[model samples]
Target: MKSRRFMQPLTSPIHFHTAMIEQTPVAVFLGQEMIGSGKIVQITDYIVKIGNEFYVRDACTFKYAV
Candidate 1:
C-alpha cells in the first residue's frame, strides 16, 4: 500500500512577480510616518510609506552571510 500526503494552499513565499519570488506583508507598522503607500517593489524589497515619510527595503540590517 502507498500513503498519500496532503497539499496546502496559501502557503508562504507567494509569487510576487513573474520570474521572482516574494512574501507580502512581512513587515508592517502603525502610527509611523513614511513616504509613499506600502507596496511590493521587488522580490526582496518593498517601498513603504506612512504619514509623511518614505522608507525603502534597504533599511533592513544584515546579520547573516551566505
Candidate 2:
C-alpha cells in the first residue's frame, strides 16, 4: 500500500500588476468562465473596482478588450 501526503497551501499575500489604465475595457473571469465585462474604474492592492463591482485581486483574471 502507498501512503498519500498533502502539502499545506501558501498563505503569503500575492502581488498583482497591470499596465492597463483606468477606463480601459476589460473582461473579468473566475476560473475559466467569464463573469463580467466593463471598464476598470479603480484599482488597489487587494481588489479591483469594475463598473460598481469589486473583485478580489487574486481571485479573478482580467483580459483587456480591444
Which candidate tops lDDT? 2
- Model 1 Cα lDDT, one tens digit per residue, 8-65: 1112234224112222222332334222332344433453333344444355311111
Tens-digit lDDT track of model 2 for 1-66: 321211221123321223244344667788888787777667777777778999887898776553
TM-score: which candidate is best? Answer: 2
The stretch of ten residues in a row with the least summed lDDT in candidate 2 is 2-11
Error of 2 at 55 (Å): 0.6
For candidate 2, the lDDT comes to: 0.59
Cα-based TM-score, every candidate:
0.22, 0.64
Q: Positional deviation of 21 in candidate 2, in angstroms?
A: 3.5
